[model samples]
Target: MEVLRIILTQSSANYKKEETILNKMTYPLPPFSTVIGAIHGACGYKEYHKMDISIQGKYDAMHKEPYRDYCFLNSIGEGDRGTLVKLNNKNFLSTGFDKVAEAKKQQGSSFREGTTIQVMNQELLTEYRELKDLLDRIKDFEENRVDKVLKLIKKRKKDLADKKKKVKENKEALNVVLIREKQIKELEKNINDRIKAYKVNEYEIPYSNFAILTTSLKYYEVLNNIELIIHIKSDKETLMDIKDNIYNLKSIGRSEDFVDIKDASIVEVVDTIDGPITSEYSAYIDYNLIKNECVFLKLGDKITANGTKYYINKDYVIEDNKRIFNKKKVVYTSEYVAEEGSENLHFDISSEKSYIVNFN
Candidate 1:
């Protein structure tokens, strides 16, 4: 004969209430077979009350031993309002209801019999929380670091601009000095020519004995002194070689001057060549990948591809299986590839995913 058991755990307040509702003073430790019969009777009563089924076939099936094991009573809730129901075994097919009920009954008396040990340490939880807080602070610090770097870059740019302005002013002042020196040299030549012409007129004085020549004639003094006494001035100046020397010093400084700047066209050409070119302007190009071969193009160069020489412009198109190069578009299919022995240039080609080629 089959049996159904409803084992109620004492841990639940519902068990006490169900005992009260059933008019059972205590939880009687009934046999599994007896519980099974009670469950079937309860199901029959429920079905009859609902008018869904008559009691005629209910008890008829109840006598069948094979169907008895299929019945179950699931008690849920607490107090006197706890539930009692008779369910078909088909509803609990996958649930292993018979085995569950047997296990529940076996565990019923021993539910609270085991010793309890403290497994969760408060100190460990506190340490974990501290670690999490530290990580959060680290993330915030990194975000602040980015702002600091940006501010530093802005300050650096301002400083560079000021330095550049100073350098330009210095250069202009030096150029003015050079122009004054050039005029002085021309005036000195004119004065020497006038002295020679007067000497040829045959005065008893050798040109060298003339007081103007006897004194180490300072060019500036010759003009100013002569003008003060005779109101006649030689249009002459001095310090031409000294001014040239100063200009040379300034040129040396210019060579040493370094400034950071950007030029789009040069950058584009550098990118196109996949390396740095020796142009009038200084620039840097970086590549992410290595490549075996690259095609060099100049302005208006016709590239023969697919049996046609394609006349390429500033916005020409070049395509390989890995990359598509359009005027303003650069798409890398893999790491930047540079030809062997071309270590001066590197390409950026870190993306492994495929990309589509299109340009506006």
Candidate 2:
């Protein structure tokens, strides 16, 4: 079988594990889905093109890099407890926010009174205060004027119902009472709608623009000096397109993990081989292949050796507006050898160096 083989290098990279949060963990090699996604992105394909990928890579070292992670609350904090930030743009909680002020004392600091508070942006702080004042005024109007008017309207409707019974003998008087009741109902609806519009447009929308956030120092497990050997098995047209646009491949893991494509070429791979073949680099070997005794682990001096089992993400289907990822069970290790040939294992002999191709 003919396959597209690629060699890529990255100075520093982080293949993020989905479950980790505080200390962002890294995968030893990029998953199938990540590699496929990168290829699709490079090819600028809007739809998922069917393909199988074999990912094998090695990294020189790994280290933790510390960074500040800001957690934004759902709503702006009421009291002066958390950090007050004004979104550079309004109504969205995003990274592009200016630090308006922060409480110096974690518990007792008053941001509004400027007591035990550190003011970062004076203009934004003033705007926040103005918005707060407007919100207060809106609340006062809703409580004192809107509520009072609604109460009066309710009482008038009740009184009209009673008056209608009294004027039942006279048709004109009864009609007048019914007409007034309808007019009062319409007026009440208009007043309620206007108040709602004012609260949302004038106060809530503008006031909520400022966000409350808490920050914590977190670490990201980053791999350095990563080298990846990837094989793509697809249709002839797809393989040719990939080889033609191999240079368009930017990054495999994170956007910041820029990849330098070292080589891209079409190579002949065979599934049947007589002699033993050992993996030159670390790879995500299929768990079933290892479990079924088709692939054996190389136990050097140690009594026993086994690779780490990882249920890595491969492909996904969209369900209920969420990506439901299909996972592949695989063993991640370089110490693996296929003594006897298996259907799933293949050998690449096109180049001077031989490699065991294990596709998941």
lDDT (C-alpha) at residue 80 in model 2? 73
In model 1, which regions exceed 4 Å deviation? 1-120, 144-149, 152-162, 165-360
Q: Best lDDT goes to which candidate? A: 2
Top TM-score hit: 2
Would you list the C-alpha lDDT of every candidate in the order shown? 0.23, 0.85
Encode model 2's per-residue lDDT on 1-360: one tens digit a residue.
899999999999889999998789999999899999999888988999888888988999999988899888787654676789878676456648888888877677766677888888999888888887887888888898889989999999999999999999999999999999999999999998998898899877777777887888999899999999999889999999889988898887788899999999999888766776667789998888877877776765322327899999989999999999989999898867775546667878653677878876
Per-candidate TM-scores read 0.13, 0.85
Which TM-score value belongs to model 1? 0.13
Taking all chains together, the TM-score of candidate 2 against the true structure is 0.85
